[model samples]
Target: MYSLHLINKNIGKFYENIPFSGLTSLRFMIVDENVQDRESLKNVLEFLGYSVVSVAGYTEASKHIRAGENYEFIITAIRSDSCMDFEKFLLSVKDFLEDSSVVIASERAEESCFQSFENDEKIAGAIHKPYKMEELERIIKSVRQ
Candidate 1:
């Protein structure tokens, strides 16, 4: 079980035991071509006690990696309208993604897709589009364990 705390910046007061990952400070980056989806997911993650940074496309996301920013988890869209190759993108950032969980989110992901990245130690899980909040939370918790 994890517990979350909210700290008041202005007063420098700490609100303890807010009911999510109290001990862990999880940072996440979201790479999705869809603006709406990216923002929506970012909001959900922030609400769930994660520090999230979201980018509109692979190019922007790569810039973050090039800058040497590290994240505890990365959630990316499998297929982008810009025709970015998901696997290639993953490989390109493998160096900066050490020990971080990678989750692929797609509307058309199949079992074969999961198997394809199964051997990659960074891949933590896959979620179909329109996933429930509970489902996403479950995957995150499972990977953390």
Candidate 2:
């Protein structure tokens, strides 16, 4: 399949969700602890013609946000060990991402985890990890509507 054609020095990770072709004027920031997932997802999104920035954890994401970097979408996985307080972290960074849609990403079922942020319009929704690049595209499309 595409794995053969896409095998190059620049894209080292195995992309499991790329659907061959697409084009979009969207930007995304993906935060995940697993290097494989983060890079693969970033690669897939990039392949589909989206601007993607992948980071290992919240700490790295904070550096970009603190530096005044903004994106149309922010897909992140929150962990108690890495980010002690999800609410506090979101609150602290809310100003910088007011126009951005925050999508919580996790391998676990995390529908209930984002309840607190329901009042805040910034939260677009939640997308489970290992998600297909198409799923993320859907979320972004919905954000426009």
Candidate 3:
């Protein structure tokens, strides 16, 4: 079993058995409209040894995707009220993202189009907000696998 050292609330610091070398080469992208949440999650991911890039919204992230900045995994917050549409963005970049894993993060996860996100083959996992260490580790492990 794995454990953690909780930070504030949006993310967790994982001390799992994942090798540091294994994580160094993996790239991650975080997309969230909230700056504080994005930065906080980025810090924890970095501390756990993964390289992370953060963008405020899907539109900005899509630009990077189009530019060919590939990522092994992407964690996005799909909100019901956000101005951006995560589904639309994902569909637009379907070809570039075919092999990449996507994990959706949200507090209001059950309310939006994300309600059926797990059914989408593009997604690797989903975690509710007030993040938990196990869920984070589980997703990372799947990505590594």
* Candidate 2, 1-145: lDDT as tens digits: 2322344344343434445433466778988877777787787678767899998877778779889888889888766335545666677788889578888877887667767566778888777766555567577768887
How does each model score on TM-score? 0.79, 0.78, 0.79
**Each model's backbone clash number:** 3, 0, 0
Model 1 regions more than 4 Å off: 1-24, 81-83
**Model 3 lDDT per residue over 46-114, tens place:** 876778999988888888888898898888887522655877877888788856888888876474556
- The positional error of residue 48 in candidate 3, measured at the CA in angstroms, is 1.8
User: What's the true lDDT of residue 20 in model 3?
Assistant: 39
Flag regions of model 3 displaced more than 4 Å.
1-6, 9-22, 80-83, 109-112
Among all windows of ten consecutive residues in candidate 2, which has the lowest summed lDDT?
1-10
lDDT of each: 0.75, 0.72, 0.74
lDDT of 3 at 23: 53
Worst 10 residues of 1 by lDDT: 8-17
RMSD of each: 7.2, 4.5, 3.7
Q: How well does candidate 1 score on lDDT at residue 37?
A: 71
Deviation from native of the Cα of residue 119 in model 1, angstroms: 1.5
Model 3 misses residue 120 by how many Å? Answer: 1.9
Candidate 2 regions off by >4 Å?
Answer: 1-23, 80-83
